[model samples]
Target: GGDNLKAAIFSAGFKEGCILLPLLGARAEVAFGPAGLGDLYVTSTSPFGRNRTMGEKLGTGKNLEE
Candidate 1:
């Protein structure tokens, strides 16, 4: 679907951006943080982010690590 494709593009953009934005924040934090992202949190760039949708999957018994 066109809409799904567009949504995936946006999602990837956000996750990729998260990979960048926090790295440029500082040196030490970047070295020690998750994916070198530090404690800086990247919120969903859209309401349709997978993390947001995970709530439903969790309701179905999916673990956070899944």
Candidate 2:
């Protein structure tokens, strides 16, 4: 999903850049809500991002609270 979106952004002439997830999350929270922009962050970093990985692990039955 991010790949496709990245390709679109690239084709549209936006240079690729990496903004740390927490910072992005913070800005999004300010704009969106206290719950944070979880979907936007996850989808933006999907497939290999730490947040995405954590979400995947949790989704697959791994427990973070041990």
Best by lDDT: 1
Best by TM-score: 1
For 1-66, candidate 1 gives per-residue lDDT tens digits of 587886677667646655675577744444345533222222233455555577667889999888
TM-score: model 2 vs. ground truth: 0.33
Candidate 2 global CA lDDT score: 0.52
What TM-score, computed on C-alpha atoms, does each candidate reach? 0.36, 0.33
lDDT by residue for model 2 (1-66), tens:
478877675444322122343455544334334233444455454687666778778999999972
| Deviating ranges (above 4 Å) for candidate 2 | 1-29, 32-45
Off by over 4 Å in 1: 26-66
